[model samples]
Target: MNLFLDSFWRSVAYCLRPRVIALSFLPLVLMVALALGLGYYFWEGALDWVRGALESSSMVNNVWTWLQSAGAGSLKMVLAPLIVIFAVTPVIVVLSLLMVAILMTPALTLLVAERRFPQLERKRGGSMLMSLMWSLGSTGLALIAIVISVPLWLVPPLILVLPPLIWGWLTYRVMAFDALAEHASVEERREIFRRHRGWLLGIGVFCGYLGAAPSLIWASGALFAAAFVILVPLAIWIYTLVFALSSLWFAHYCLAALQALRTEKELAATTALAAALAPSQTTIDVQALPLPDDTTSDARPQS
Candidate 1:
């Protein structure tokens, strides 16, 4: 608990660092550029397709009629755009997170290590290729989880609980491994992960919940299509910042746990060596006592 809270506060403080603030923008920029480029190319086509689908669907047509009857006909104009926005949102979020993980996590982890654990050894256990593979694999699984879980979303309680949990798990998996990749050996990383899995996952889950806040902007932006241009980028930036903070949080927690693991091992080794030498040292001291100089004592006893 102490460890968790300590890392949490440290991460929060680090996020305010100028370096971190600057680092966060890289992902944001990349996401914005990608979003804009795609928007420019596919904007009209996507809208046309969504409108055609909505118009052709019996269920949606009925809903449109009901909404018109209820005098909320204006909503129908935005419905297709809203659907498109929601559809694209998940992609933006995932890409932003991956960009931050790939581009920024190493630097953040290094910064945390240099500042807080200068003496910590770098085992270079995980390479960039391996980290990329791990991240992609985890992300793929998370996406699959989302797809499979969508049916359950109709259950309101499950809807609230499930997505964040999946995102949390994904965040935990990606961030924790990246956090320890440079400084901790494979064994050390696994050990720290096993020991601190719960706390790390809790951080991920909390950050996952925080990540959901941007959806409000997305929702609002969709409702007000006039503001879509501004809000979409704003939401992407928020996602980038959230992931950056999450990276820092995981970095602090994992690195601290790794440091403690090494310290504990060192202390154990020192104690074991002392224990192993104690009997030999006792014997040497006994032997060095010189048998009380029996000959000299005998010779002097007559006096």
Candidate 2:
């Protein structure tokens, strides 16, 4: 909890840094703004196109006939391409953003880590792919649970535990691992998550399932698809923000874990130097840390 809270703040501070913030989020905010622009353009087009199709068709002659004859499957057949276009485009945009976010994380850690453990990355831990996979896969599961539970409005709230817990574990790894895995890449991270397919699925089944929302994000988590108007457009933006910040928070944990696992000399050196290099105690965080998982490790960094 302590670790996550710090990591969360670190991400915000790192993002807002006079120099780093300008360097990092300038690209990010611009990209987001551009993507949003493109998204709104296309989304409106898709809506217009769908409405035009429905209006042109005799489907609405009688709502029941339209429903019984042209059911969702039938409508999907007609709108499939549009659905694919609208759906896949946003996904691509979000993935692009994640790529950027992952790249930005190391920059935030570089200054602090260098002043503390100059020889970072000699420590033990999963490979880059392995570590990133842990975080990505966990988040992915959270998404899946949310997607799968769209029909069960009454049950979604009960499935909300998965994301937070899985996310917390991933946060611990990200905060702790980066100090040891400087050479890690985004591709490696994705592959690692792929390698641990079962764990990711298990996370969803066990905990991520709790994150399932009967309602999509923008629609106020509404239980029914009837709320599509509010959910569709805004979900992309809202979910992206939540997921991105959450991923950064997790990354902070693994990065911190990387530092924490160092030796006592490293710890002493860090304790002293951290005051100068560190973002203040309030700046450093442990809330994002995993619940002292024996499933992981706790050795401090070496000087």
Candidate 3:
């Protein structure tokens, strides 16, 4: 618990640093540009397709008719845009996470290491290719979980719970691995995961909830289209900052854990060596030896 809170506060403090703050914008700029470019190309077509799909559905038409009778017909205008926004929101989130992992995590890890754990060895347990593959694989599973759990999300409470849980699991997997990739060997990394899985996941889930905050801006964008162009970059920037904080949290936590693990193993090794040499260091009783020299000398003189 101390470790968890310690790392969390450290990460929060680090986020305030000029260097860390600047590093966060790198992903933000790239994501914002990519988001704008995609929005330019596909925004209209996606809205149209969603509107057409809604129009083609008899059930949706019935709901629209009922809504009209209920004097809530204005909802019909926003529904397509809302659908498009929701659909694209997940992609934005995943991309934001990946961007942090790819662009910001290494630097953040190094920043933490250099400042706090300067003596920690770099085992280079995970390479860029391995980290990429691990991230992609975890992301694939997370997307699958999201799709499978979408129905459950209709439950009001589950909606809040499930998405964060998925994002949290993904964050834990990706952030923790990247944080330790350069400093911990494969064995040490796995050991830390084994020992601290619960706390790490908690950090990820907490960050996941933090990541969800930007969705409010997304929602606002959908409702107020005029502000979308501005809000989207804002939301993307928030996502980048949130994930950057997450990367720092994991880096601090995992590196500290690695240092502790090595210290523990070294202590145990020293203890074991001392135990092995202990008997040899015991005092011997020279007086307890049999005295055969006098008898032998007397016998030789008599002969």
Candidate 4:
């Protein structure tokens, strides 16, 4: 519990560091460039498709007619763009997350290690290839969960519960693995996961909620398209910063757990060695003791 809170605050503080803040923008820049380029090429096409689909759908047309009858006709103008925005928002989010994982996690992990655990050994348990594979696999599972859970998202409460939970699970798997990849061996990493699974997942879920904050900007962009040019970059930056903080939190907690695990193993080994040598040392002490007085006196002088 102490470790959990400590790492959380440490990560928050680290996020404020000039270096970490700078690192956060690296991903933001890349993501924003990617977003702008994609938007440039496909934004109009996507909007057109969404508008056509809405217009062609009888059910949607009925809804729009009903809305018009109810004096909410202005919503019709907003619906197609809203659909496009919502549809593309998920992709943008996933891409931003991947960008941070690929670009920022390793650097952030290194920063945390150098600052807090300078003496921690680098076991390189997970290589770059392995980290990428792990992240992709976890992301794939999370996406599957998201797709399967989409229906449930219509439930007001579950909508709040499900997405963050999936994101949290993915975040936990990816960030924890990356944080420990360099400093903890496979066994140590597994042990840390086994021991601290709850706390780690909690951290991930908390960050998952933090990650959701950017969605407000997305929503704002959906409502007021004029500000979207400004909001898109801002949303992407927030996502990057949130993920960066998550990387740092996992790095701190996992590395500390690894250190504690190693210390425990070392202490246990020392104790076993002491136990193993105790009888021998007792025998040596007994052998070195002066002869018993009666036996020695009788043998030496016969009184």
Candidate 5:
């Protein structure tokens, strides 16, 4: 836990290198577009649902006066989406931070995999355009999950799990992180995930939960929503840096513990570990695993 936090700040220190710092805000920029565009489209549906739900329930009914006054009803219509974003602000913030963190990951992970590996090259492949596309791609996938799990909100659990992992994986792509990794594609990453599946997911779930914390209050008032817009970019930068550094540290720890080896070689890595350390370091220790995933669910209820 301490190591993750420490590594996160340290990664931030490195990411602020004159070059990467310029592009660090890329994810947040794309996210704003995603939030505005996605938010606009979803607001109508969310409002209808809220209105329908309010008609039958005593809970939201008390606010009917507030709901219909002037453009109040219209405002209420966007409330659900606004609230969702508001409650999940922390997660969103972390997600933004994840962008910057991902940018730094290639170099950071390189250092982890190979001692004194040179700093990763900062080439622009996944641009603001790419992240927007990433958001669109991921949002489409998440929307599908939402549809399949609707009414019962089974999707919340998945949301609690998926976002951070996706962010991490996206970092994998943009940061060229897997230069040291054995797996390349989603298939390979999944395979690597499977080999050390338990811990890998544990890390993802843990980070996602924490990442999703801001969303806990996402359903709150206008003030909170305003606060969220202000806080999101910075929060995300911090969140990504912290989560990525922590995750990479955890990954390194897992590699040390799990020893998920390929069939061909008993000694998996190249000159990675010292010859002296290699003999004693071969065995992985699971007991040293870090924290659990965050919240059980967002404020959304099961139907």
Candidate 6:
């Protein structure tokens, strides 16, 4: 609990740093450009496809006709675009997180190490290639979980529980590994993971819930079509900021945990060495104590 709260406040403070704020924009810009490029080329085609799909469903078409007759035809105009946005929101989120993990995490970890754990040794437990592969694998699994859980989403309680859990697992897996990659050896990293897995996943799940806040903004973007150009970037920026905070949180917690691990090991070693020497020192003390010399005991012998 102390570790969790310590890292949490530290992360919140770090997010306010000028460097951190500047770094966040990189992902936002990349996502915005990607969004714009795709919108320019495929926007119409995607909307048409969604509309066609909606139209082909007799039940939906009947509902649409009723809505039109009820003088709510304006909803039809936004529905297709809204569907497209909803369809793409998950992709955007996954991409934004990946971008932050790839670009921001290492730098944030370095920053935390420099400021807080400067003496922490760099053991390079994880390499760039390995980190990338791990992230991709985790992401694949999370997506699969999302797909497999779609039916379960129809259940009211499960809908609230499952996706965040999957995302939380992914967030913990990726962010914690990247945070400790440089300074902790593989064994040390594994030990830290084994010990702090619950706290780390708590942080991830909390951040996962935070990550959902942007979807509300995304919904607003769909509702107010005129503001979507602005809202899309805003939503992406929020995602970037949330991921950035998550990275910082992981960095602070993992590095601190690693430092504590080293300190504990060092203390244990010192204690072991002291114990090993105590017996020899006691023997020396016993030997150094002068034995009763024969000459000194002459009076006792005569007695």
Task: Indicate which candidate wins on lDDT.
Answer: 3
- Cα lDDT tens digits, model 4, 13-113, are 99989998888888888888988999999988988888898899999999989998999999987777777776676677677788888898899889888
Q: Candidate 5 has what TM-score?
A: 0.46
RMSD of each: 3.1, 18.7, 3.2, 2.4, 21.8, 2.4
TM-scores of the candidates in the order shown: 0.90, 0.42, 0.92, 0.92, 0.46, 0.92
| Candidate 3 RMSD computed on C-alpha atoms after optimal superposition onto the true structure | 3.2
lDDT of residue 284 for candidate 2: 52
Candidate 2 vs candidate 4, lDDT winner = 4
Give me the runs in candidate 2 sitting further than 4 Å from their true place. 1-15, 26-30, 33-37, 49-97, 119-143, 153-180, 183-252, 264-303
Cα lDDT of all candidates, in order? 0.89, 0.47, 0.93, 0.88, 0.48, 0.91
Model 1 CA deviation exceeding 4 Å by range: 285-303
**Cα lDDT tens digits for candidate 2, 1-303:** 565456557755544446553444434455556555765677667657766665677755355365557655444333433443434443443353344346644554555455444665643334657657755765476457545643553467643543344433433344334433563345444444454434333322332222223123422322344654445445444333433444444445444544453454478887889777666555456555556666347666779
**Residue pairs whose backbone atoms clash in candidate 6:** none
Q: Per-residue alpha-carbon lDDT of model 1 for 1-303, expressed as tens digits?
A: 998888889998999999999998898888899999999999889999999988999998998899989999989888887888877877777888799999899999999999998988899999999999999999999999988998898898997888789889999999999998898899999898888889989999998898888988988987877988999889998998899889999998898888889999999999999999999999999988855777776785445
Model 1 score (lDDT): 0.89
Runs in model 6 deviating more than 4 A are 59-77, 295-303
RMSD of 1: 3.1
lDDT of 6 by residue, 261-287 (tens): 999999999999999999999999999
Off by over 4 Å in 5: 1-23, 36-150, 153-194, 216-221, 225-228, 250-303
- Candidate 2's TM-score reads 0.42
Ranking by lDDT: 3, 6, 1, 4, 5, 2
